[model samples]
Target: MTDFITRFAPSPTGPLHLGHAYSAMLCHDMARTAQGRFLLRMEDTDLQRSKPEWDALIREDLTWLGLHWDAPVLRQSEQISSYDLYLDQLAEHDLLYPCSCSRADIRAALSAPQEGHPHEVYPGTCKARPISDRNQGDALRLHLDRALVMLADDLPSFQETGGTHKGTHQIDPDQAQEQIGDVVLTRKGERMIAYFLASAIDDATQGITHVIRGEDLFDFTAIQVILLTLLNLSVPTYHHHRLIRDENGKRLAKRDDARAISTYRNDGRTPSDIRRMVGL
Candidate 1:
């Protein structure tokens, strides 16, 4: 009764802080308690920001917290070809196209006045735009032709709420069409494969049974779920945990160096102190 699988995937962009410690400890402990397989993966896809030193430190820090993984650590940077193949496959399904919309273009488009609408939705200016139209400054996007179909037709998907998921859901397809509307599935210039693609592919390739991460990313899960279906990859259950916040009730990040593990270590804080500090 224990075929659970979990992964602690940490980006190697910065030193692990209290927030990271909390996520790591929580994920690893839950996996262990279920007698499941726990794995480690370095999300060092951002070549510009990811440092090998930081990756090494995360491994050391998690180990210091008495957590272990079942296999050699997998790194996202090593799986580019795998991602590329999936993008091409989706295009073969006629589900992807090229787009030239920049961030400013998108934000500005959404800001424009529209039929008494209070807020902006991704108006899909490029939805009907032909792909042959020069991809000048544009990036490749996964067309949501089936996004509405999958959701309306009762797409087989599940959400993990801190543990194993249950039952298939008939997602509202309009949400994807409105919120996503063929968002960029692959960009030509970005070193990091967009988060949605990288995560969906990694989870499938790694046999990850559950994806437990911060809830702030819950909105983005729909995109990943959509991608999983597009790529013919298995959708892992998702469990978005509560984030650890600072005294100001703001989310913790590397920007908060004062809460860095190194800073705590320098002040002679022990492993047990970490669990307490982060309220684990």
Candidate 2:
């Protein structure tokens, strides 16, 4: 069997837009071309927003696009306990701490600029909070300083096979510390793991060899790589393909129902039409 395993993981919180179709078709085509496996994963970890109807609709849209995945599709909602184990592993290293800061709090901190302080990144409002103080409703954030110190001599890096930044890139501690800061791993009281952490863990667990997704996520790859390296998991090659944007050049979001795959299909567009529209 080929080792070029990949996945098209999408949250079932909204309709499957054209952007989703492009990404799914790209992954499907790549795996088929390599005679490898293309898997489907429902990132339904957002318990509040995730719905069974949306999940069904997403699968239906993908199937209608003539795309197919292997048996036993994985769902993130069912893997919470497994993710909790990973979080515990990080906690064992003292890399995680409780964060009670809300988005508004973070925004206010960033807006009120302090000298030599990074504006866009988290200001470490709860960095001093110990893990032992973690309550039922507090979010968990990775202490990048300690995590980087743990891997001082061996910072994680990955090879990019696609996108404008095509090359072997290493994680720069300074950029990660200043720009990315201490990122939350779990939401407040939700028990929902962050996208980067869960996706990284899932990629390793599923034996994914290549991560094919939009270039918008390229910047966040380093943090994921760091997590994988910390857990001693295999890091996958990433291909951040160009996004399929609308006529106004805005990248498609779930709310863009007019550009949804189902809408196009309902308008009498065929699978070939989709491939052509996406320039595949």
Candidate 3:
């Protein structure tokens, strides 16, 4: 059996929240129970919005929660060049395209007799257009149509984290192909690369064997799976744990300061209390 490895990756966009606590604790506990190594990775890819103070706070919060890791956390903001190399690799394979469409244009152009994730379906006006012909836009999208055609003959199964299907739930590939089309690989105004690409590369290079995150991100799994295949990297097992929602059944956000881990910490709440609060 492969030695299990997991990581707690948090973006320092804002303070940690109840949802974050639940997810981090789950990763911490699972790695411990399985005798796996749990790593700490700071996802500060969004350079414009990410701050060192918040990064420091994230470290402080997780430690206060009684979670410690090996020295030298994997901070992604320091790894922009690596991301660019991967992009160059994809570009060499003719797998990426530049997208110049704006959000309003996408919404206006979409003729959706279709379903999608939280993001509205892209109209794909520039899907067939070449990158050179497109304007300098804020986001860059993966060429999904080309990607699927390439996978038509060799669609393969990627490993997901154990306990992913502890209940009755099913999803189909046909539905996946239809529902998700070309999505952003790099967004405008984002200093570094986007999450999907950064995540896949980091997980592969860091020797991560199990990728654990929230189930809300479950639908986006296909994008990363394709990334792993395109880059010839091993697909780590994915464990998308449940999220912490409030009475309204909405996932918690860092903006909700009342539930912010800093707020809780300031209120003299212990990490044990956080674990209990989020029912981890």
Candidate 4:
């Protein structure tokens, strides 16, 4: 069997919470079971919000949860040049286009309701515009329709090991247009890299074999697969596990500090207790 490599990447915008613990422990156990490797990554591309204290606390929380990684943590902020390189590759293929549309601009352009969210789909207003006309302050977006045509001869498929959706699947064109529209690869503000572009590139660079993440991200896997295929990177198996939610049946967010791992640690909860809480 090929070597198994997995990662638990978290943005250090806030303290690690129960949801973070659940995802981390799942990846850690999966790697251990395969006798392979597990990695930790600080997805701190959002420079404005990410904090040094949160980074240190995240490490402490992972250690407290009895989880271990095989490599020194990979920080996304340190790898800006790598993302630029991939962007250049896309540009060479004519798969990327500059977009100056802000959130308000996109919302106003959408004439119909989108599948998940209207804002999720880009109206493609700037797609036909010349690349030379794009300003330095504009964001970059993937020309999804053209990208699919570029890979029409050999689109990719991925294995999903997560319980909700198991087995291999292919990207469908109809769903791609409705659900996975032209996604922004770079932001206009201080944070230049988007989650899809950054995480997809990091997974390939880190040699992540199994993308063990939450089911909430299950719908977005197709975009990453497409990005990896376009960049000529190996696509990894995906295992999007169930999310850990609160008593109200709401998935926990970083804002839910009451459910933060640090709060539980301070409350005298043990590592074993966390495992039981998340149903390991």
Candidate 5:
């Protein structure tokens, strides 16, 4: 049997709030229950916002919460070359194209009201651009239509153990083409990769069997699964747990310093108190 390996990946852009505490503690408890490995990863691909001090503070807060992760923590910043290799493979398949469209440009092109659409789907302005035409500051977007056709024989799907949309769910080609058209895999300047791409590659490379995260990210799981299938990597089971919200019923953000774990610790809150607060 494969070991139940899970990970708690957090961006070092801000302080660890109650929301982060809930996710980390949940992952830690589950790993311990299964007697499996719980790994820590720093999702610091956004180099502009990611800071060394915040990274140190994150480790400190996790330790203070009595949540220990298996060592040596993985940092996405160190895996740029690895991510590039995967991008290269996707490029070779002719499934990626350079996109130089800015937000204003996209909005201008999409002037027609896209009512009932939850997200602003890219209009694929650069879909016809060849890979050879990629510039230094251009972003790379996936040709979802072409990729789906490539996987026409066997579409990508995943198993969800938790969340509102639990059970087996398959990626519908029609819905994907409409809702998730030509999603960006690499940001402009090509210095950073998209979260979907990086996380998908990391989960596969680390051999994570179970992905435990917040329910808010559940919607984006399909794109990750698609990328995994395209890369011929193993897809892990997903468990999207409920988020820890503030008293106002709003989801806690990094700016919510009052609900930060560090604040609670400084106010003399115990780990057990935290577990109770998060309904663990």
Candidate 6:
């Protein structure tokens, strides 16, 4: 087998849809074709919404679609301690700060809608505030300005192989501030680890050489790249594929049961049908 390793990670919050199948199949086929390892990860960090049943359903759907993942699926819920360790390292470097801003607070602060991303680009509202003034319910946010300054001379670059955005890209100081602002590292909940934080750590630790995901996440790749650079971890090549959209040209959501793999299976759809639908 080659040294190339890839993963198909899905959150256990809903049924496996066509979009999820496409992503999983793409990752699986890539690894199989290159004689590399394909790993499965369950991103069940949302304690309130994640369910074991959904995890089981995901496995069944993947199996029904004739997909195979490496043994011993990794669950994000089991890696909180590891995430906390990295969080501590960032804190020691003074690149993290407490954020007590509520959703309403953020919405009120940003008068205009955030371009290219769904969530509002954080305005670094609580960055200058003292960490001692942090409340128990407060979440942690990355100080992008301070982080960039810390890595002033040693900023890292990443390679992309997918879509029109393919190339070696460097972190633009101006773009980082304007487009990707101070992102939250932790949230005010049981599972404090944010998606970017956990994903960066997992990709590095698991030795993932290539990251394959939808183009919708293209904008957020910079955030993960920054985190990996700060943590002194290896950055992998990225391949951002096209997303599966609905009739309205909207990306398929988890709640869209009509487009779900389970529904297709019930309607006598074969694995080949799935591959054909997703243009495999």
Please, what is the whole-model Cα lDDT of each candidate in the order they appear? Answer: 0.72, 0.85, 0.73, 0.83, 0.85, 0.82
Where's the lowest-lDDT run of ten residues in candidate 5? 107-116
Write one digit per residue (lDDT tens) for candidate 6, span 82-167: 78888889888888888878855432222111223465678767889765666776777888899889878977788999988899
TM-scores of all candidate predictions against the true structure: 0.86, 0.93, 0.86, 0.93, 0.93, 0.93
Off-target runs (Cα >4 Å) in candidate 1 are 103-121, 129-137, 150-152, 163-169
**Tens digits of lDDT, candidate 2, 187-278:** 55656677778888999999999999988778778888999999999999999999888898887888899988889989999999999999
Model 3 residue 244 CA deviation in Å: 0.9
Candidate 5 yields a Cα-based lDDT of: 0.85
Q: How many clashing residue pairs are found in candidate 6?
A: 0
Candidate 6, pairs of clashing residues: none
Measured with C-alpha atoms, the lDDT of residue 151 in candidate 6 is 76
Model 1, C-alpha of 41: deviation from truth (Å) = 1.1
With candidate 4 superimposed using the best TM-score fit, by how many Å does residue 266's alpha carbon deviate from the native?
A: 0.9
- For candidate 2, what is the lDDT? 0.85
Instruction: Give every collision pair in model 3.
Output: 138-188, 160-238, 161-238
lDDT of 4 by residue, 24-57 (tens): 9989998999998999999887676789999999
lDDT of each residue in 145-252, candidate 5, tens digit only: 999999999998999998687899999999888777888777555476787688889999999999999987787788889999999999999999998887767878
Candidate 3: Cα lDDT at 218? 71
Q: Give Cα distance to truth, residue 242, candidate 5, Å.
A: 0.3
- Model 6 residue 42 CA deviation (Å) reads 0.7
lDDT of 6 at 51: 96
Model 6's alpha-carbon lDDT is: 0.82
Which 10-residue window in model 3 sums to the lowest lDDT?
107-116
